[model samples]
Target: MGAISVKSKHLLGLKGMDRQDIADILDRAAYWERQPKVSDALRGKFVANTFFENSTRTRFSFEMAEKRLGAEVLNFSAAESSVQKGESIYDTMRTLESIGIDAAVIRLKPTGVLEELAGKLNVALVNAGDGNNEHPTQALLDLYTMRKHFGEIKGLTVSIIGDIKHSRVARSNLWGLTAMGANVAFCAPDTMQAPELEHYAPFVTMDEALQADIVMMLRVQLERHDKGLIRSAEDYREQYGLTAERAARMKPHAIIMHPAPVNRGVEIDDELVECGRSKIFTQMEHGVPIRMAVIERVLTS
Candidate 1:
């Protein structure tokens, strides 16, 4: 795929996006963070939150971002729409476009559909999440969090630990972090590993994973896996969870992160979720500004 133009209106994913484009969005996010809570930046525009999958954070975060920018918002749920009656995602999106939405923040269960929709749609398309493909805004907020803490992304080490085989967060983080010069690593059980991503980063042990500058835990997506991969929550936690003992061994400056709705004790210990070194909630706070920047950029640029 070609590099995304600076003026590219759609934020499909960060996989092949330009390094400078990522930096620009982060920089703009910092600016938005400093401004007042609301603005008329996107005034007179119509933005739709069209989700084909269930989401809490990403969906609400995009809605908050749109409202902050003063864009009129339309929230769409697959269950409440004609999608339940067998309408295609493409047709649903087209219907929104026909209704004069200037942009669409979409989350779908199928991969590659957003890319096809981006090519066919007249309005800007922002990827909220698409299967295990990518979640650009989540990655952007993550990068923003890291940059806010460490002051730069280059030379930092980020270890993403958990179900790599079914994580769009891990994939987006891998692409964006690598583009910004961070060394990325994956730590997961054999069955949870993504073979396709092995060439991009090394698969390390729990000890090696904890040694990185950033320790990101991914939610164990039990829904995507068969019954045998993980026998029980306790078993999975003992093997891969960021337990208190393991967190104690991490470097003094390393921070913890997760793209939530976290699995509490399954992927990370409950206490560590809000520990001093954890940036989980901070990541959520940054989501609004990062998404505001993305929405403003797509609509105004």
Candidate 2:
């Protein structure tokens, strides 16, 4: 196996990142936001997207970011491949690497796959999602969006609600939020509570977290359905979801955010999605530029 080595590569996660790395990348992303239309920073470079799991928004977002930066992108969707018949991700990545692909973004069902793949490959690895482990890019973009609204992340109190335990987004946000000096208070029912965050103080009500500067609601993972987790969707929604009454309780300036594919009437009131308070759209919009920064830094730097 020929190693397509860069000076170094970045994996998508927060555990290994120090404060400087986070700040520097965010500064680069801020520069991306200012460029307006597009740039040719990665011109003539080839990027591979190995999506073992299904994704439209994230895939297209990465594609758009790559194309905008003037990089040629190879999208490998699993449906058309032998992955459906059970192909290993390492082999798939090796196959892509056999060609002239320079970098990779992977979405898989297993935690630590990107880190494992990164060690074996020469190219930079972006963890699109690894099971419910962590979605660092989403959290980065979310923070980037938050910085725009809140001036900076320092001291911003962010309340994330919904399927905390099963959400890669939640795990990532918790890390990013704390790293940025933003205190995070995520709320969810015991069923949806994120157990890994045992050290952090958690609230059971959206109202409790809404008391902060931002309320980041995460989407529940329906794909990992377990009957023991819920008696009924409506019942869960009634008890733990963000509702109109809850929305009204937020600081008028408190920015509302969701990673999206939001279950309406579940994690947020529908009105909050449209109101002036919502930063969800901003978070989505920032994904492309933030990813562009990530690809450029991990590949070129």
Candidate 3:
């Protein structure tokens, strides 16, 4: 594995990042994966995990990563914080820094919130997820999982299906995977697809896209569906869900993936979540070391 060299002090997004940087982080993650769980690298440091929106996987994954690195973790809750009384993201971040927090992993409902805070915060800021913008670590762990499976991420066909219009995962994976030379494609219904991404000739049919080496199914984003983007849940499943029929059609070597909090029987078949070819759980398992790499990179550099 290559030596990890990350120049940026904060992990804002994957867009326009050097391919070497991505590889470096993934390499560090691989190293961490083989090491014992507990680490004392950041023993004297303190980090905050602030989530303005609800999350289970990303939140816990980051907490675990921080604790493993021997950093004191401050779990910030939006509902219990001054933010509930109208404190802004900037003030909250600044307050955390004032209290001796070295870095923060933040997730917000607004797209540009993280970027706006990046310039102002004295401490390193990691973007956990910003609205429909991007989730950089998720993409990195995804790359690690792919590399573990195929021995390389380059030259693999990765099809991202469903809710491309509102999926930060799609955006992150699109940029990261393509930067690593993976053939990226998007598949979504007209209402769920981004018009700007039409240049890739996104497959409207699951059959065509499923032929790829990796088939990533995305959640329907029910929160966004309140605006009537989807005609019917049942219809959406029939049209785009990875049913048993579609799952069977995937290449024998092709793997299935979904960033979790999966809408069972919606974006994918429930049975396939643990199917031999499905790397869904493995992806979650990769979250810890991948995030450990990210935390180490941002805090040290």
What TM-score should be assigned to candidate 2? 0.93
| Residue 77's lDDT in candidate 1 | 95
| Candidate 1: segments with Cα more than 4 A from true spot | 1-5, 224-226
Model 1, residue 153: what's the lDDT? Answer: 99
Give TM per candidate: 0.97, 0.93, 0.96
lDDT (10s digit) by residue, model 1, range 157-215: 99999989888999999999999999999999998899999999999999999999999
The candidate with the higher lDDT, 1 or 2, is: 1
Q: Model 1 — TM-score against the truth?
A: 0.97
| Worst window of 10 by summed lDDT in candidate 2 | 1-10
**Residue 10's lDDT in candidate 3:** 97
lDDT of 2 by residue, 78-142 (tens): 88897778888788888888888989888988887777788888877888889988888998899
In angstroms, how far off is 289's CA in candidate 2? 0.8
Alpha-carbon local distance difference test for all models = 0.92, 0.80, 0.89
Misplaced by over 4 Å in model 2 are 1-8, 201-204, 222-226
